[model samples]
Target: MLSQLTYLSFLAVFAGIPLSILVMGSVISRRGDHQPVRVQVGGVALMITLALGYTIPWDSYLIARGVWWYGEGVVTTRLWWMPLGEYLFIVAQTVLVSVWTFQYASVADPTVGHSWRDRLLGVVAGVAVGAVGVGLLLGPAETFYLGAILAWAGPVFALQWGVGLRYLLAIRRRIVVLVGVPVVYLSSIDRIAIAQGLWTISPTYSTGLTVGGLPIEEGLFFLVTSLFIVQALVLLRWVIARWG
Candidate 1:
């Protein structure tokens, strides 16, 4: 039974993830009348930039290592199904989260010129969401990476972008900001993971680490990929409540 299941799992990993993302992404893209070409472009750009940026050095490092022994086939991370499953995961994850949070962008009331009360609400909201989301979906390893994306990214983005608006207001203008941070941080985690084989989308993805009866990849994955979907869901909920 176990062997049969493993075979099926492997088959799904090889066949499933990438295909679904393409379909889902397109469907979601067309849902909004006001959607911009740039959002789609940005997604492409992010995937390319991140994939190239990460894969280049990762391949290089793997090559540099005595033997990468890499090959292409269905690899099961068990979190999702597909070859380069993480890519599809990232893309689908990105779109959903961006769109979801983008929903919150409706709250700003552009005529207001940004309100501190709202900002405080956003911070409180984001933090509350982060904490609660973290609590519901999180565990120890995940607590670190996902937490970083959710809690810290908002403030970090505010500083970098000079976003003087409150959190809710910021969402109103665009929840893309909310989406971007988690995406970037998650992408970073993936890049690092692939390079180190902390977790993998392909059969050959691996690193020489294991702990507490789990692959290092899983531990790292626990920290990274799990919350991506949740963050997207939460942001989307917030956005819909505000906008819809």
Candidate 2:
């Protein structure tokens, strides 16, 4: 029998690819919608690249510190102590999210706007989050998992908002509807994976807090990750339209 991680690895790809295809189908099927093919492709590519760049190092550190651990033999391969499934996860999740967000944008709120003040606050908030994440890393916090999640996630989220808040906020409703559906679905899947021992979180590095068997940090991880992708998609639409 395949280990749970192996099972999950297959599931992750299966889920991610079809869902992305579904989103693309939705995008192309919509009447009167103009798809920005080049920009969408480029933006999603960047999102995947950046997502891996961040998650790989962060996850490796967390695993090394016992913040969480993947079950032994769950993966058939490992890269620097992180599972191959994880690397695929970065790509799969981003594709699913990027396609869905842009699809929703085409259907519901198709215009992008700008706001200088939101931009300013976004930069300031990103800086603050970075500062706080560093402090948490250096602080005497009994568990660093929360800090670590927030440190990276917070700044990335804030910076994306800073540059793209106007566009994001314009379609905030679509964002909420689109992003919420997946977060709930994925978080539930994640909860099951954790429960099944696909991965383990160390209580020593966590607050022992959980929601419906999912840790608060895990929940935030999904939320921020979705938001980051959404913002990036919106910003790409805005920039590509403006300058492309």
lDDT of each: 0.40, 0.74
Candidate whose lDDT is highest: 2
Global Cα lDDT for candidate 1: 0.40
Q: How far is candidate 2 from the true structure (C-alpha RMSD, Å)?
A: 3.0
Per-candidate alpha-carbon RMSD to the true structure: 11.2, 3.0
- Model 2 clashes, total count: 0
Q: Can you give the TM-score per candidate against the true fold?
A: 0.34, 0.85
Cα distance off (Å), candidate 1, residue 235: 13
lDDT string, candidate 2, 1-244, tens digits: 2344463465655566678677768757873257557766787788888888878888887877778777766777777877778777777788888777766665323356557988897778777877777777777554477778778876786778787766776777777887797788778878877877878878877778899989887887888788788777766666766666
The digit string of per-residue lDDT tens for model 1 on 72-175 reads 33244433222344444445444444443433333323333435665555456445644643452345543333333344334422332232334333343244
Regions of model 1 farther than 4 Å from truth: 1-30, 47-88, 99-109, 112-244
Residue 25 displacement in candidate 1 (angstroms): 9.4
Alpha carbon lDDT at 136, candidate 1? 29
lDDT of 2 at 167: 74
